[model samples]
Target: MFRSSRGLYSHIPCPVLPRCRLPHCLFNHGQQHQTKQPRQAVPQRQISNSASTAGSSVYAGKGRVSSSLLIGQSEINEHVSLAFKGSAKRDAPATESTVPSATPTKRARQQVSVPLESKRSADAAANFTAAEDEAKDSAVVYILPVKPHPPALHSQRLQLATALAKALRDNKLSTTPNNAASTKELEIASRTTSATYANTMKQHIISLGKRGKSVEKINAKKTNEIPSERILEYIPQLVHKEWQLEENKYLTALPSQNEIEEARAAVASGYETCDRCTRHFKVGAEGQSECVHHWGKPYRVKGSDKKFSCCGEMEGMTAGCRTSPRHVFRITHYPRLAVMIPFRQATATGNNFPSAVALDCEMGYTTLGSELIRLTILEFPSNNVLYDSLVKPIGEVIDLNTQYSGVTSVEDPGIPTFDATMNTVLAKYIGAQTILIGHGLENDLAVMRLYHKKVIDTSILFPLDNPGLTSRGYKRSLKSLAFSMLQRDIQGTSRSSTVTRSTTEGVISNEGASCASTLPPSVVAPDALKLEGHDSIEDAKAAADLVALRVKFMLALEDQKRAGATTELKIAT
Candidate 1:
């Protein structure tokens, strides 16, 4: 049966299965019989090289089977049927093998054999072309160039003045009019008339000369005709009855002891005072309060045997151990003679006068040393001119100090006398309750011989304290305060021009005198000369403006405090 099966299978022309051996011939026959035909073409190159050997073996085995098989009709019939089926399968594989062999494998071989460099070059070229196409399709942009503006034309007079100054400085000309040629040259270059130019030049020269000299020399020269000491007997008596009447009419009443004590108490309570050191401590709480007085310590030099005493008086042989209290007081603590001055409130009358006023005074050298030459007062809120006047000195005129006083010539018929300025100009605007504000107000008040209780001094407001030094009353300049706090530039313009002209006009108008008697020079001239001195009116207005700014800042701070307090109260509730 096995021989018959092998003979039948070999004659059936099955695919060369060399792996099928006689030891497992039955399994091989069964597998071959069960195998399905392939659906696709099997290329001749894809077939194994062992196929030919297997095919030869199969044919040899078939020959053996044919030779060994017993001759019978049934067996012949079975072999014929099986050979027919095998021929059908062999025909299909033959057709497929022939189809692949006819065509060349050139396309497949080329795909596998391409060089790496050629592929990389092709890929790079494609990428670059694509990038170029994208760039061409994008939009173009252009930037426009900017043109610069032309320079502006400034003041011609200022330019000429500057040139003249430069020329004088270069020539090393002594600022005194003693050099007539230099003065004339400067005047001509400055484009000013001889008379006007001469006066300005002479003043400038004298100022420069005086600055170079000692204070004693300058004072001696200014007061050459007058005595160094106060000559009370030499002072001329008030011959005019109007002056006496004016003084009597404008005299302010003194404050009582009760008001003074109340003011002191208020200051002690720490209102409006610098509490930088004491603010952290509970003022009156036990074990928390700090001393208000400034203390001084004894010091000994590096190699000295003796020790320096404290500021306080020395007790026995040793230096005083206790700290000394300074006699410092705020402006608010000062007692005012005027009663019931309104605090930043307008008066009941329709006069529209401000509650506070800022004052500035200019002094000229006289037999009594420096005396008030001009006084200017400005209303606080409105900054309106309350009082502006040129006052004749109480004693014999020594020097006008026009370089600083801004009083070029004090011969105006409309200018008020010292008595009239105090009574009519100042008294008309200021009340007992009015708060007086200024820089270095004590000096101004002393020169004016006026006693004002409610005062606001910028010097006191912003003290220039040098903690290392023992000096306590160091005051800051009004210019510095205005520049730093108010962001304003003041006292730059010459006071002689603006102040003198305005003051003369104001005095004339106040006294109802003819305008002709106090007419100012060309308005343009004063504007041009504004570079020359300090204007009392301008100074007063500047001080007032500073105070107003301070008031606004204080109000803003108060508002913030109130808002914070209200928020805290709401949370507490």
Candidate 2:
């Protein structure tokens, strides 16, 4: 065994001997040689590189040994003796051989000779060991430093922190004694303030009630139950038979004339000329002048040139007249008579029929009880008057309900009969597909003897708080709804005198001759006269306005939904 500088041992195979085969003797000699001469270790760096070089040199010497074996015994013995001599020299010291020689030729000549097979095995072993050393030296490994992380908090500490935060939040929300006191004071003040306002409004309404005589008349007429026999006496006499026939002919004519043109023709006829002004006041003309004393007031002198005795003057005041003279009628009055004018029946076609129309009807006491006296229809949004007429009931008139109806007399000329309005105006313009909008429309339709299915009633749309209440309380009033939802006032009057006069006449006719002396005096506050009779045009338009507002809000909501849906779709994409 020979120790290398890398602390590794290299073992030599059996040494060659003569044909006598004395292995024990050879072993003893190898031991004696190793004891006599110790080998020095080789350096680790030189050991790996020199290992293969030394093995090749030994293989070269072994190739010559086989040729020597083919020689005679004398030659073989001579070769064995030479080998022994070389072994002696080679075994002298490993240190001397490990030192690199200056001359490569001298190093080759100094190599030890041994058996061919043994040298070959030793050379192969050395080459393998050298390869292993080279592989180990060429390998590489890397190590990286680790970083330390913060330690986790204990469960108890975390719970403590959470509780502390919660306690602090609670402390902040808890009201102080001063704050509590202040909140209570504010609530009390608000209640007191609200109560004051409510009381004020109630007193104001009561005061208005005393001043407006028309309001009392309206209420009385609505509540009073008149006998059917007595109602017939109020009906006007059919004195103008010829005129009625001619009016009917114009109404029943085919290819009906335009309503506006027909109205012009009626004014030109001069049949309904005002007695005082002698100016023709068409039945439906707004703000027309007429004698206020047409019913023969005691204050007016009874003569061909009838004059006002109340003012103690014959000439009439143009601006304000309280006598027999032409006077511009109220807006309410104009629409009332305007509805009486008849137009030839023309069937509503495509665009001729309005998309939506709001309707309202006024009923008067007649032999048939309550009867439809006036009907007003207005187109939605545009608010155009589609059809407006005073419809004479099938039965005789009893009370004109002039307080609310604004109809002064049944004898007013140029007014179309109920049959004519129903056949010519209502039937022609209103169809099954038309959307009829109104407030409390059922009553109006029932009075007119009309059965329209597509109706939007504001009363139904905006129901009262307790809808399950009695019939009278089940629906909200149109005036209340208009004021609340639309922030508008309708069916209100600033001048109570005109309303009182109209109402007094209606009451007098309704009650017969004896009740005139008992009638209430004409007195009303300008601002307080807002809660009175129904105006057809005003009520119809109010209903339409409500529907329009609802539709506008609905469209806005639909647009918002559509916009949100579009945004979501885009986000999804």
Candidate 3:
């Protein structure tokens, strides 16, 4: 289960106000907001959208989510903005009545705040007229100028110095006659005293003009809640120790079915990595059968340090309180994989060898391991379905893995059996030259007993940089990717109780399910599989589209770089 962070890093930096040294800051007041990483190419920023969804497999980008500790989710960030136009005169304080609770008359006259873009006033600032411009509609605060103003400046140090300086300059100069010698000498002495006062005033003015940034920095540290930016800054180092690294020596980037089979026979015999707990165990171990896990992804609640599991439990409070009848293991070793009845690689007969392909599968817990229940494949670029079907699994049916998968039944008389379907249906569309696409297909490929050399995994393509959450690492959900990249929402929504049939779009199969959606607050039995299912066809198309979008972004970035270089060369000449 997972969601991506649009908080901290997603908010646009405050607009520069040229000389914004006001007692009351118009921009980020108390928070220590940092600008996002500067992109060399503007479109790279758009990658944030496409990051979750990009990849290719005839059917790829599984949105099947389980109690995965490697995939993380967090609250979407909301931008906060406060702006004021500089309409005050060169220098004069407002009357005491003008300010809500100013201590003295001097403070009232000097503190002037012009509202930012008010239709009611003809002189509103045009800088932030549009609410949704770059700031994404930073919470618009509409404070009327006629209303009583709150005490603006909080830093006592600046206030005291400012008031003292104003008093010295405004009052008439008076000297004691006892201190002066001759009239001429007194005049020279008076001039020297005046310069000293002028210099001191200048120094205080400079310090006060710095917009209280130093004071704000101190205030930020005292804040009780952690800032979103601080959370983002620490994300990279938060990768879970159990999470597999991209360069893990235990497995190759692309291991073939044969290699995995050999490993199963030699070293990792009867061993499996549980999809729920991420613990390795012998398939038949006594204690291994029971799995205590959350059926949903973990998320960080906004404004609170408290983290929560999607299943409605405080994160880290317990080691997955919900117990499953069977500790379903994700098939990584090939020998233990379920053999699916093929609809036949009927499309393989065609001479056309697709360059790109996306794939997705649905699965159920079986005696042998997780078995493939449904498979969907789509051709790249065109998004034509090369193959799609429901298959009978190899083991005795246990739980259908439906809480995350959303698949309710295979008992419909229309469901096809091994004998009814033709074999080699997948071999037809995917060939040596074809590049397979999916999101986190490692587990899926093992179920298919395939270790394709040419593969484009969305999890690898657009990894979640944040690893601070318990359920996150490099991999993210297809739903997150689709929403981020394609700007379209998919999965669960399309597959309702009325639509569970031979196939659907955005569904995760038994093999490598990657659903990000979570179960409801209530827990359901494993056998129930009551959750809404996903569509492989929908995810497949998204994977292909994700890859295509990435390619286009890269090309555009290169073109922009070239244009910039050429312009610079002309100027140098």
Candidate 4:
């Protein structure tokens, strides 16, 4: 076997350094090298332009390293960068420039060429190692000297750098990479991967958040059901501003002589404004063929472009996708509205009035326009029905709108007229000071043409929780409030007829409609619930209960404040 150059020069002392740290060094140091006086080892980590020129491939500034070697058994001193590189080179075959006069020696012939990439990589590794050691001793880059990693981890770091270099060369680079991109990939990867844990992970920043509990859940947990009567006390305090209505745009104006005559002519001609399409149509000739409308309200796509919920088509992009069985209408003009049931100035607040009342009205399509079909009123806190009736409309019936109104023409003849029922039935229970509570109370008040001060409209009472939903023109619905706060379900396909009374059987006469004196809300079985659309009585009670819940949450907050104050006082005293 041919002797290698490293084996031949194994006994030679390194020329520049007084003590050779390398094991099995390769350079010839016989008579030719012995002529030079030995120099001291570069003062621990002291880097200079000339310090590493003779024995090291790397160069550094006036940098220093006070820390000991981190390379474990394969230790590199102050010149770790150069020491590591020199050691690696000695282990392999030695390469050199050709001496013109000398013949090629056996040792020289044994030399296998090293790739440019390999030489650059070795030099870079040496430089990085030196810089890091210098950074620790001088506090130039890093102030603190980090504890050396376990010796076992060095090989993994090397392996990771190798992998990263391969990936950089193979993929991540552009058509023409940066000038320094060739050998620096390993340095880049090494520097990045050696990072200590971030403060978020190391400093223990995360903690548990408050658990969510709904109003109903909190009440059940606390084991204290707030009294319903407390609703009256907090009603004024809990009422938020910007929700109270002062005037009436929604109320139909009382028709004058001209409006009455014009309305009479319009009725005779059978032409009325189509509430859905906004175009006038002949009621006598009303049919499904000509009418088209979106049954659902308008909404937006991704909160920008407006569209109808029924068809998901952009508004005005096409005609209504849903064809009605028959065209229905509603009257907004007071003169036209008054012709059906003359608009009445609601009796002003007076001494004899329930502190609060929940009012709901149901309507059906009529020849004059939309007319009141049913009205329900429940007193607050107690939730007792102040009034409940199917008020007979004077206009020729067009469509009962029974899908929602829960009224039919079969009993329309026997029901009380608008005049008799409002004057006698509703007048008996309601007075000036009554605070009417209902979701979307404006629509009900407008349809009934009953306006009074001191109102608690739940639609405006509880703003939608999400500002995004509010910006998108969404109103908080009563169903969500009842389910969330009270844990009660109302306005379904079927419900109890007491609160769930049958729509068919509840069509009482004018005399019976006026006799609302705490008549126990008839509680029929769920099977007997005949209400097809929404129940006015159920909705009224829901609105009332929701207000009661607000009072309860207030009571809870008050208790919390009182408890906290007491605890602090005790601690101080």
Candidate 5:
């Protein structure tokens, strides 16, 4: 193997033979080679490049040799032989011969035939080399080293040649003065100016390749002319000037105070006197006469002289009487009024159609000092069902029994409370401005702490005639009113069980004893809750509908009374 300077190794030229030297191995043939010189090993260690061992053949000098050597071992078996090619005079036998014993005479005989053959081959090899040298000499030509150019000749050769060529050109009397001037100008231009020298050599080299010399004359004074960028610096100011010009063309004129006042008065009169009939108009009423009217024109008129004159003379104004010729006309303004409205009617916030809304409350009821829990309020006037749930009390108690006017609870432990379900019930049915009609809603509002004024209570409408009956005397329970008006009982199952003291205790015991511990309390007598979910939306609707129904009935009865009581001509019977 051969290694080159680039750290690459040539492939092994041939497969391993027994007597061949390994790249770096200790053993060869039957002996281990020893070197007397102390030298660093090329690879620091000897490695066997091939796996061949005893009996493996090593081809050397036109014959095969066998290896039976071990690394670093002294014992060597001498079976070495010499092989030689045949000469023109005579040929030796080709068969290999092995000496039976190691002896000095036999070794001498084995080596003696090779020296005579080698002397003859040396003479033949010298004759071959002489012929090769003679042929090589015949193919070659000799070259000499180049001579250096003269210093002055090398330095100015280009300039001298250019000037000499120009002078050699033939001149005639017909030559224009412009040509001579141009040549003189080019000579002066060749002298470097500060402007030309300011640019770098590389920049000039690149530019010279792309473009010939510029025709525009360069002056030393204008080396840094950046006119394009200078113009860019003032672009914003120029744009602003253009914008001001355009803005002035479309500027809006502002309305004066007097014009604004006149506009307001016109609007006021428009509402008061109908545009179709110019007279004071009442809602839900018929007009006496139709009149032509103006909605008023918009203008930037000076002074508030919005009135126009009629061509005819004024009735009250005469020559002697001192009155202005212009007659004064009065304009009336209509006031927006509030009236009793049904829950189904939309509020004055001007949402035309009515909508259902939910209500809720937080109140204290259970145990003397228990925390106030949320009370449920549900109303759907369109559906006519009210659901009010009583929450089992659980936060800071701010009031006692009846302190929060309208909460009632069930004795059953498993029933879900108002606090748990009120929000769900309210969001499902009610919205902002729902008119929740209840009796003495002040108490409900106090417990709820809600501040909506859309609510209307029947107790406020029905004040006592005796003057002694305020809330305490005339306040009616929903159940009592329902019973009186509809002649049907509307009972809450939890009401009796939650009533005070002995009555509540007895009622709970009776409910518990019915199952006799054989079943759960609910199995014997299931809770008879009318509105089972304790939802606020259902309760608010029921309450509002109850009031609306009563109002409609009362209005019908009054109308019947007026019809019956009216005096008419009596016919003779």
Candidate 6:
């Protein structure tokens, strides 16, 4: 975008030539034409012994095309001489010469010498030649002789002054006159008075002479005068000013102001100011605005009266620039964050690996059974916290659940609403082809209000291979699976007996599981006790981790089915 204007500046001061603006010459008339053709071979003749003549001995031979020789006049003559040898006859020479004595270099003429008949006639011819030579010698050199320059006297000087004045008025002078100054001022700037200007005029005359203009000779009286150097200085500035004037006229000849403004508006809508200006543009936004130096050149003013110079720098501004958005405040991870992310559709096609992490969210109700709060996204494979946004419930916490899904009401800290939190966290995931992994992925997908068909539910993958496991697997919570395979335990929620008085008063689980869906008391986790409340991020992570734990061993046993599951672990490690 940073373009150089040196070439443009160089051309700005050039003299305007009318013919230079005309269309360029396209065809080269002097170029020659050429053609190519395939070569053809001429057949050779043969002599037969059976067709012998009466007096000559018979000889026969077959002739073929000779590749060694070129066909030309000499070869044709040789062939003719050989073919008519027997019928050839000699003839006596006639008085008239058959061949000329000398051949002309050009085809138009040849020389034939004839002997002179008598000395008298030759002498008479010689006398006529001598008289012609003498006459040519006596004739004056009638050359288109070059004449010397006329004297630089007053008469010649007056003629020059008149011609110069006429040429200047007609705008026919080679050099442009200064339009910025009056005639008297221009003459002063030229540093020559009428009395002493003849010396300055001489050099101009000499230059004009070289260009084929008629010039008078220099006189002895004018020989010692020196040409003024100030005239030389005035010449360049006048030419420059004249060129600027022409540019001003041309620019003024452009379209209407309304048209120019419309064009400017069109360009402005598509482009923006540089970063410095953008900071001033969006001063109170959530994310920091990123600014970059502008690549624009200095602005220029067109006319002498325009006043603006070509030295003022211009900067461009842009909006919504970020290195990374997610971890904007996470100073430790800031270096790895990518703010202006380009979203890509999840694709299972091509030779790409089929592994992906999954996340789930959980919400719980207040004591009054009125409002629901808390939302979290969990990263599978490692059960890492991707995002956990606490949401203030619409109602107050009354009865606390101490069993099953592990959640309570004390966690809210005046955080945003569930909708706001979800909008922020969910935006990080959910793309065209992302593969979500979980136990009952459909239910989790339903809770998150996100749908992706490329998910792999361990419940389905393992069940298809083990019928017994399938029938008994409903008992397998993510915690049970995690304990059995990965040897990691995740606690569920524990509710007091008073709070659990009526199973009808079902507290809100963000994923919304019914009392019927709860596991038996015998297998319920003792450590599933709620501190202040249950976290959605924790639950989502637990579920995703449970699937990932079982998936590890499941992948090992079935190589082709889940081989890609290990790709994520390798990258994370």
Query: After TM-score superposition, what is the CA distance of residue 46 in candidate 6 from its true location, in Å?
Result: 94
Q: Which wins on TM-score, candidate 1 or candidate 3? A: 3
Report per-prediction Cα RMSD to one decimal: 39.8, 45.6, 28.5, 23.6, 50.1, 43.7
Per-model TM against the reference: 0.35, 0.34, 0.43, 0.51, 0.24, 0.26
| Candidate 6 per-residue C-alpha lDDT over 63-114 given as tens digits, one digit per residue, 9 for 90 to 100 | 2112211111232223323332322212111233332122212221111101
Residue 459 displacement (Å), model 2: 0.8
Candidate 1: the clashing residue pairs are: 175-205, 176-205, 336-453, 341-433, 494-530, 494-533, 495-533
Q: Which portions of model 6 miss their true places by more than 4 Å? A: 1-355, 366-372, 380-383, 393-406, 410-413, 462-475, 492-529, 532-542, 546-573
lDDT to native, each model? 0.42, 0.42, 0.44, 0.52, 0.31, 0.32
Best candidate (score: TM-score) = 4
Best by lDDT: 4
Cα lDDT tens digits, model 5, 389-425, are 3445433232322322333444457544444443433
Give the alpha carbon lDDT tens digit for every residue of 1-573 in model 3. Answer: 122243442244446543333333334423432333223432332222222211110011222112111111110111111121122222123343343332223332223222211211222223223321222211111221111221121132223333433332222111111111111121222233433534543454455444233322333223323433442233223221222323221123344467545655664566666788777667666765577887777776887554544557777778886788666665444343322211111224344666566788777887566777776676655565566666666666767776556666666554555443324444556665456677766656556655454556666556543323312444578989899868867676335323321132333233222222321211111232343657666667777677665554433444555878999999999
> After aligning candidate 2 to the native by TM-score, how far in Å is the CA of 291 from where it should be?
31
Task: Please give the lDDT score at residue 477 for candidate 1.
Answer: 75
Model 5 scores worst on lDDT over the 10 consecutive residues at 334-343
Please say which candidate is ahead in TM-score: 4 or 5. 4
Writing each residue's lDDT as its tens digit, candidate 2 over 1-573 gives 332455222243335522223323323233443343222332332233333232232332223212221111232233433433343344433456445332334334344322322333333323323443222111111110001110111232223223322232222221121222222222222233433533433443344344333322333232223332222221112011232223212111222246545555654543454433445454333565534543212243456454553344444433224343232221111112233422222334565665567788887755433567777766655566656556657655645656566665555454567777677545545765566778876566556656445556666555444313422445577979889877767656421223222343322111111222333221111111122456566677778777665454434444555878999999999
Candidate 1 lDDT, 1-573, residue by residue in tens: 254444544445335464443432433354554565343534443233212221111121112112111121232223333432333234323444343332336543222112211232233233333443222211111110001110111132233333434333333232211122222332333344434644564565455444433322323233323331222111112011232212223223444678766765654543332222223332223443323432233455567543434344332343234321211111322252112121221123334444567789987755443577777776665555555667776555645655566566565565667776666644466665566778877667656767555566666445443312312334567878878866766666433222222444333121221122333221111211223457676577667666655444434444555878999999999
Evaluated against the true structure, the overall lDDT of model 6 is 0.32
